[model samples]
Target: MSRQKTESEVARTTGRLGPAERADNWRRLGSEEFDVVVIGGGVTGAGTALDAATRGLRVALVEARDLASGTSSRSSKLFHGGLRYLEQLEFSLVREALRERELMLTRLAPHLVKPVSFLYPLTHRFWERPYTAAGLFLYDTMGGARSVPGQKHLSRAGALRMVPALKRNALIGGIRYYDAQADDARHTMTVARTAARYGAVVMNSSQVTGFLREADRIAGVRVRDVETGEETEVRAQAVINATGVWTDELQRLSGGRGRFRVRASKGVHIVVPRDRIVAESGMILRTEKSVLFVIPWGNHWIVGTTDTDWNLDLAHPAATKADIDYILEHVNTVLATPLKHDDIEGVYAGLRPLLAGESEETSKLSREHAVARVAPGLVAIAGGKYTTYRVMAADAVDAISGDVAGRMAPSITDRVPLLGADGYHALVNQADQLAAEHGLHPYRIRHLLDRYGSEIHDVLALGDERPELLKPIPAAPNYLQAEVAYACSHEGALHLEDVLTRRTRISIEYAHRGIDCAEPVARLMAEVLGWDDARVAREIEVYTQRVDAERDSQLQPDDQAADAKRSAAPEAREKLTEPIS
Candidate 1:
């Protein structure tokens, strides 16, 4: 005979990542011997941890900074087959990514990943349609079965109806196709939390200083808590490095040259109000360099991506005036109303970890990933795009088979839905009831359902005692006060930057860029983390300086000047140091 679970019990059993959980995981890290230890808290690392844990392996994961703090959070936020890659004739890469996209849409993470449509504006008149149709045909069928709609061809007038913001001369016709997109930071953190639910010890703000070696073979890692400078040795039979752009840097710490090298390709994006572009669907246009995207974000349009090589400052890849100008110049050619600098609300830059090749152009590099056993017990995986993270993770863990003691199970992450995935559709169906119960609008309830899924109950439970938390933030009304508290209580947010930048995306969505609400957000976090008044003030000051530095960097003309300006801000994790050999 079983009893029904209380609301509090349900929240407790769902793997809350609070401060107590971190303290317990730290003790286990110092005390236990594991089958595998993964470094890097990006999507691949989080995915690798989930893959390892579900296979019944004892596993632990550690990140130097906040999860997705580096490249993962600063992405184009799409999970689709790289349509541009088809022009490069990378068929297998497209097929693999499409399959992953279908899985995320239909079976796994249905809450986080949603189907989005894009219009490929046809500049050429006659031959271009058939040529593009041929490519689209291959794209639609290559993924086997999909949940999204197939391609539809439209006349020039039809295209204008779909996107009235487009210039009359921009295209003769257009083709609309379906893809998927998600909040990348939220998805990556959910992957990590799902790993924790499956019994993988996970912690952020912990850096790998040096490799632990047993004679010639690698044994484990020496981890330092970047917040407190506490050191621990997490022993493991195998170690996997899934660091993206920093792959080579982490490989060097192992004192071994990796099987291949990784080069950093910088990509920059800018955000503007959604009303600036009067479109029913997103647009994809061609450039001499690469494809330009006008992605539809909530109340905003995300336009971007200049692909150029970047060598300086892997941690904070800065966007210069040239990069922003390049994007605006290309996108403005197609828009009816040209976008200027003043229309821009936010800017961000991220690096793609491409496998070093003979070509000097970063856009020419392969999108396929590579996994190699760099040392006896060490494996390194790099050079993959965001959509195919699960495949990259599986290949990485499979590379370390010999290091583990017993026969390891094959990767089961494809069948494993993320933490908030289950029961999401059912809750979405109950949005009206939820809104009535919580005294919120149905739109707000639907938003919470998308972000939290079935775990919306856990998030709402935080407001039970303090109903004031249910109200929206004064400046950033898109987010609730409960969400900020939930960042620390259930998402392992350590500092103010983690909440504004990655956890909730308040930084990039608003014109003030999280500066106006930094103190209020910090105060909300302090309630859960037990911070003093001085500590709250310090968090606000650090976050404000970061926003100021980013604004200053965007005015710089070149990468060197932009990097210097951006790097001047104090790191949130003050004790974090360079990787020691």
Candidate 2:
């Protein structure tokens, strides 16, 4: 019988199939060719891997770093149809995105994605309100907007009543529209895990050093185990390049004429205390080239993102001074009480892998993606928004149908619920009873459900066994100690950063940046990963330096100056030994 995959089963499988297993498998790749080998474990790559595997293809997905470590995780956390795309007359894009959004919320990832309301404040007296209202009316009638509440128009007095933080003068009136929000990092990781569950041999920290070729035809790849610095050849029938901004680098490694240029646009976001921005719904403000969103995260407000062209380090893009200033200036215009540098609790920067169209403005460049068969055995897909990743993956997989030689199943991802999605509503209904049994407040259980969905029982499993793990973490009380331990043991979190930054939001949610809780969290992780005191200290030090560098960058005068400062910080050191071939 195929064994049911439990939490422990998942952990054991991942630990056993780490870097060493990666190397051994790579060495045998050419001898036992995979049906498809996917490079880049971002959302698109992960989604693509799942699509191919579900269709009965033998697939292997490799990433140089963590999954969703790139643009996928750094989004505005919205699964939205670009309402602004309508202004540019991109009706088709918005309709498709809206349909996908509806699918995700109602059927696919119901556990992870939820509806969020946004207030579009009209500034001008006469023309703007009617204009904005007409657009929103269209938005409501479009594909799946009906899944959410329809638009609500409010007068200036009514607008201020809804969003008391806004100055009365800022808006002539307002219109509320519906969209969906997601935990981007969590969703991306779940996508990768879903792909793994479907039989994709998903491995991270396995870097592709070069492409494998059989004469003129491209074949597979020469991959390095980033942990051990060992290399092996992973041969496949067809390879897909979904490396986002690293597409050019992958092409150079492949030694081919690269298909299309990918230009990186840097977007920076600042997080402040929730009390600072008093709004019932999120706000969207227009900018010169793009738009800025003051999105509400739990207990915090996320105000960002300045969009400008970037030519900096792809792995860790730094927010320049200009980026920060631009955001502050635009946001300040609408706020009754302005936010200063110290008022900011956290800052983050991400790069958008936009297809470098001939347009001078990056914002005007199409968000639509392109899939190109660059070589006989290779295909590369790039340039799309996160909301439409599934469609993009399906398209990329469809491109390789000729080479696969078998009748393949249609894309089932739209119908395949993520791991936690099934039975989520039923679990939600029983959360109160579960919370009382577990000695947690009902709110806590609800919180766990939102983050873990039905898999919350797995998290609670550790607590049930060890009552001590049920207590709140010392410095970061929002998280339970069991959560910290679970991340390392189950989520492939090798280092403290992975646990703090990705697995949990302590790095961004707290002003201390988890410094006070680092050692305790490290200790909790140590029990599972076998880290000693010295190792724990080193991890803490590395994380502290990273936080310090980010803080220093935020103080710089402009993007150039901020990037220089941020880049001065040491590069991330390897935590595990590279694989041995």
Candidate 3:
């Protein structure tokens, strides 16, 4: 049969690179010009690239490390309306976040983001119930709350029944509110990928070493490929600086005087087995300074978040015993069965790039983000929550449109579903059939669908070629062989840390820190990546040392001591000594 060519074919033939065509197109980067160059591979930068590309502007995104290597992947993993922001009377922030939440859950990355219920336990009976109810009532109506159900009030007895792990005396009642959650790393990567799908040049581990200046205006950047140690000069009419915590450093690189300084506030989270906390839903507890969340991940409960001023290392913020104790102390007061040191399976620390303010209270700092036109051709955006990244992205692209020569359209990301969102529903309906045809269990098919959505077909195809790839991983029985291969091929997972920490979440989900599974997983990855036995062994050893370093640091008394101990681990990337031959 003869194929009919349409306008879409015309568009494709007009020489545009889709997501699947990015690596090849990125090869032609230094040889051509870009309309807009984006710095930082965090949520905002990736979104900006997507926004600019979808608006029919030529775009390029460069990252110093892998995508979401910064604060984007280390977030609370919630797509919320900033319930705490409401207390601060930041109604606009809350509304904007909620609107973004609705977009993600409904039209955007539906598969990536899903609704989660949180139990806000009431410590005061009469005053709190009505007081909270009024606020929640208003919360329900604002910023398109249709994506999640409205808050439901529960009595003291009812609250205890829902969260049996909580102390019976801790709450007088409770209110259950709904918010969406997502795999932050996966979503950020998908955003970058989707942007590439719409004709953006997305490349990872490519650092913008220096800014290319044309007199007073910023023209482009000098990019160094971290993997190959190759340098390229990428020219663009406009450059967007979306480096979250490193905004000042990027500004300095661009020779632009930053209008504001971004201060890093360290937040630490501990992950423990879910069985230790027997609860029907997640809990939201108020601490002395800030709020704490007991979020439910797949096989574990994530209890956290100590907010303190951090002047230490930014790359890997170490969690001390004191930080863990602070979280455990406060949460233990509310829990019927207290958590111990041995109960924790994982500990992670991330810095919040709060817009610097005069206030001493880090918690009191604004969650509201800002975008600035730093130089003649440079746009910088910082200090935004993950939920409002799209807004930040839209604002960023808008800031640079005047500088872009060609006509640039407004951001239409609100209507744009992410890479795997379009056919997710149909894939869910077809899971059973897919499982039957593939000779795999229906449960496995469901797991793949939840993680990859419609992209499950791509994963299945990997195993389809080699039936051995369908079998379960040796130690980590939950993951399949094909997943390890898929992570490397499709997801751009270069290191073992990328696979364990972000891609599959084995770092936190497993009790042994993936020690037992590391070798097997590394071997599987080696087969796909063509890594020799020595290289595979080296990867495993490095990962093991990192796990050991983190464990040793967590057992330390103070942050300084813990950070010093964790810093003893090897560097994330090698220093540039010998250039690529």
Candidate 4:
């Protein structure tokens, strides 16, 4: 049985991904024949790396940019089984997702994934309540409820009491059911860190430039450092592509026909202050096209999302005026005080890699993932929700297990816990003691514990010699000054955008959209990244332009105009162009 971690053990847990790890991994990539080389640093790729490493396999994961800087981070942040998928009779998919959700909540990521309640309003009079109750009953009992509470039926008045923001006539009644949520970016980062802990060489800002061909079969990959422009050939027994929306694009780079195609469906979200919603639980409403979720985030409510076809730039999906207005108008239909443009604090858009099918509606596309060997030594996985990333990763690795080495172990991620998960519950009980020791508020210490778990001490150690690092940031007061430095020194943050956008939610959590604290954050990051005055100024300029471009894109009436405006901003690095098919 496992026991609580000692201070020395916690200190040496060493998922510390500083500049040294990057440099060392970069050197080691070319020197060894890795058992498996996983592409993409998103949740699936990271999870795959973790699974492979934990099974005594030599693994290396490469990302062209920062971890979860793509669809992974921009998801709805839910660990819930798809309630809507039940309507389509996708029982196996729902059951699989629910099982994974239970694992995340109770065993794997107790510190990160927490149970959240959602109010499903009944708009229709008679059969709606019974029908929804039946569905929620299945949802609650599908896999098992070892963590979150089951569904509870409530009257309209009771529902309004749960969510005071709902209008009087918004519903006849409602059923509040439990689901889990997490900071997708943080979860993905922790997965990468856990992989590192298990001896996986995980590095971001390393892009695969081309595939290495061994005559009639596949061999390895040639990759380039997006930071230093250094090229290296990493010989691996097999490679798994978990590039999400870029799945089709990466398949093209291999010069082969993938088993299937992936279609990009753009989903946009707007952030409003929590006080604006005045809700005890999140709200889920049905829209003509899809569904809208007014999710409860800390100190803010996240309203989203618009599902539509996107044919433009996949890297930076833009939220158009139509998308924003659509979300607002739909969510406003039941609001006690309808949200306005002024209430909007931030906006973001992400592309979902839905499996291309006969269904014209992107919302109807299957979230059930598919894995196939596009060529010898190459496996491609795509089309799954963020909640089921582990299953997807396990499947992807299993596809190549036979070819890579002899008698590989079966997927054991079901029993594996992420870094900081082991000692998390104990630390939560010691929040007050931790606060006193660290000279922080109990609430603040608790917050840090949730974010870092047992790794809180490691982060707190950084401020031991520098007291000023413990203070909160001026512009975005929710985050501390040390987080900026820590993002670089320990989180593989290479640019200012990496820190603001994904490392933290500041970019989309505030009205200023991290503009006020951009310079201070840049300065803090510069201290760790060794950015000169010129580089700092340039970093600030690029981030500011990106924000401006997003703002400009949101004013446009349609997708084409918005895409053009969003694409006008320069990329931080020269991303590899998709090879001609």
Candidate 5:
């Protein structure tokens, strides 16, 4: 169920980031002088743009690729306080993350973020329950967890009742606690859209080539349109480098040694069907290295995450055979029926930009974020968990006080809800009515509400001229044709890869990894993007090759071989160049 907003509320905040919007923003990027110019289009960069825009600062955000194309898109999709961090005695970090979790669940993104329960199995009978209970107590009470339910203890029989797929000898007891989850890519894109709604000029496929230096201080940046190979200059009082794994690389481009170096830690996750694991609630298992999670997706189970050091291509982090085997081997220990390679529907790898530490092990690295003014007018933010991105954005903006003129207003993003957040509850209650009006099922309407919230009206309005757009996609029936069109018209999705992979999860959620629906989706996009027959064929070819490369990479034995296989595919943004360190 979802709620509806008034027409004025929708019109006021639901500004489209369509093709025209990008063209207008590109003109402003070259002509307008801004107080802040943000590099990167991940969660942090988008959040910084929002934070600055809400403060009445003239802001522009430029991304090398589509929004959430990096680590932001390929995460575990949880807005959780790292439960394992509590064991590290990092109470402040856990509490801060929990607070942010609560904010997103209640006031911030109620439509996107939802409460999810996780059961922790107790192996050693006597001490394990109480020991885990104490940590969970701090988790619930330390942060204001008013909306979510508290912890509950269950016996072996109770545990088996909740999760029938778990092995009988796996645990003596279980403890259940609450956390939150969302579509990370969608949430990040919404934040960027919200920033645009607040008057920030946000454009994707626009890369920052180099820093514009005036004497010793940084003035702005040299921008390049990755699509057209044309260049322009953006003048600003302050520039924020929020490129996650690429932080050190971007800092070097500014001709300054960074105060801290960001090391890339690779994490891999595999997606399997829901029927493979018969669990009522998600599970948290203790591994030798770190904790493993079995998260619940719509009709699938997302299990994984192997943490290891990565030193290869930052753009395409490959998941090798060893990585997939590691996850399956660990998870199979407790499952009644073990999962195999044949059961895997999808596999993805992402790099975390951890601040380099003395510890050689990537798992031992800190999740705490740091902000440093690397130069007179340049600030770089790196490290940090996904849950604390708002706090990080605030700190990054605060560090630029010396660069910007006048006493800049403080960040008000804490109070500012993302574009689709407001009036979402009312829209949930009106889902049936919306479904009736839009000529779709109530379940489909509910799906749209979760993704677009009050902006569902804007998405549905596109189908008025073309009634066929309201139907479900041929191969990817989970999504509608309207969504494919909306990705180009409203969301800043330029390439077919952007639409299939980021804008929608067809790439990972389906068995064919979007190959089955490539041609259809490309043709749908062509209607909005003005692509001819040759262009449509080219888009499908590129996307198919990328998918084939990923599949081949996953079969490799190690990172080196996997990287070679994955990197063989051509980039969707052909004109974009990687910044040399």
Candidate 6:
């Protein structure tokens, strides 16, 4: 694990995450000693593993669920410089985030993160436009927002041309600004894959059950695979906890008081079809509580989100009736044609781990993250924006690198492009030719290239012998059958829910929340995962119940009621007997 990487070894760039890799990593975790063992598989954890591995340190990143299965996947999916933070006068945080944004946009992850425009609708005519413009000007200059175009001012007529769905009197004018957007789940998974390419043992569905200690000094972690129920002792010189909202829970297991407490705040979003609100670009509207966004998705417009205090299940933050109603009520005020319940396609909820501070409301809580050496050889980082994951990761590893022997290297992640980053633009240029070679349309080839980048060949290779995989999924045709197969074979998807929910996003992208495709997707996963008939049936049952629970939760009036309803669905993985160490 401590061997230095060589130039010819770049073929490892695929960063494949399948059952075979997981099994090999599990065996390695039991036998080899690591320089750092990172908990949680969110973006921060994945970034930390990359930071450690790139520094020539042996590292392993473990997660209880799929990569980005938590808050990382359910973000507003923007790499903006925190336009709202500017209002709070948090110049430094915004500046740091913008720097990371430019890094992802220009160098690190161009394939996943792309430029997106948002129109800030004006209500107060002269005052609003100037105020917003000044704020945007500062945003542009603060962190080198040069990757995308600067802000553009528009009159009412021009604004209507931009978004025809707006009520005639909704806004007097508007200002358009640029920011980057990404499929958060895909981006996080790529980061993990990149870390693996650099020789980090990255595996999902591996839960850390307890901390390992040697005479009161942190030694390593006791991990259990959620899929196989196999426990292993993974020794490390240092351990990093990047569990986000679950920070407090892990800290308690360490039997220590944390440097700061984390508070959970629930944010909910609803997805509707693209035609629901006719718009050339996304829209941003002001609300008394928080800002509302109508972001443009591929074939849909994502409208959301409501921010409120949450004291329920962190894993499954349920979106109640009131939450969806609040969003519709606010967005309805300006819409020429108000969206109805039937127009809704999907709903999702994620909990933000805000650093608990002196704030009366969760919305006003601090988002700036804090890291601490909770104990000897143990480090924990909690609370930060999604766009600044790299910075958060650098700081986490910086705290523990002193414990590793020899001269520790500085962070080189700024120059480290993700797995699909190399040759992405060139492949995009040859999309038509690639389509011809693959017997598909140019648009489909372009889509695959954007998602898989240079690794598009690996995905396409899955269907070389089995051509039917190149066809679309019967239930959710937007995604090809090969995608479902690749989810298990290359993306570490262990269950049917993981395939529909995180890996491919058939859950939120479709109207049925992927229920119709549950059986078919499960069957495909079974082929790769070696699931029996009973296991396949259970996977489908768990997924169906999960979908039903979410719908039931959305109908509830409050958090407590919604949580109780949502928790009714059983976990996809059944509890196994004591793990064979």
Per-prediction CA RMSD (Å)? 2.3, 3.1, 3.5, 3.3, 3.6, 3.0
Model 4 TM-score, 2 decimals: 0.96
Task: Give the alpha-carbon lDDT of every model.
Answer: 0.91, 0.81, 0.83, 0.88, 0.90, 0.88
Please provide, for model 4 over 386-428, each residue's C-alpha lDDT reduced to its tens digit, 9 standing for 90 to 100. Answer: 9999999889989997668688888899999888799899999
Q: Tens digits of per-residue lDDT for model 3 on 137-165?
A: 88898953586778888988888888999
Provide TM-scores for the models: 0.97, 0.94, 0.94, 0.96, 0.97, 0.96
Superposed model 5: Cα runs more than 4 Å off? 1-13
For candidate 3, the 10 contiguous residues with the lowest summed lDDT are: 10-19
lDDT by residue (tens digit), candidate 2, 1-581: 78777432453233223333344445555456788899988889988988898888888888887777788778788999889999989899999999999998998898889999888899888898889888888887886456899888998898888889998788889988889999788887778777766767777777787778888867788877675677678878889999898887787777787779899988888889999888899999887778899888888988888777888778778876667778888998988998787777777888888998657788788899989888888888989999999999999998888667688778888888876788899999998899999999998888888887877887898987799998999889888998887776555566777778887878888899878898899899888877789888888888888888888887787767777777776544463222211
Candidate 5: tens digits of C-alpha lDDT, residues 30-131:
999999999999999999999998898989999998899999999999999887898889889998998899899989899999988888989997888889
Flag regions of model 6 displaced more than 4 Å: 1-13, 576-581
Clashes of 2: 11
Tens-digit per-residue lDDT, 269-386, candidate 6 = 9999999999999988899987999988889988888889887788889999999999999999999999998999999999888888759687777678899998998999999889
Give lDDT: candidate 4, residue 302: 89
- TM-score of candidate 1 versus the correct structure, residues matched by position: 0.97
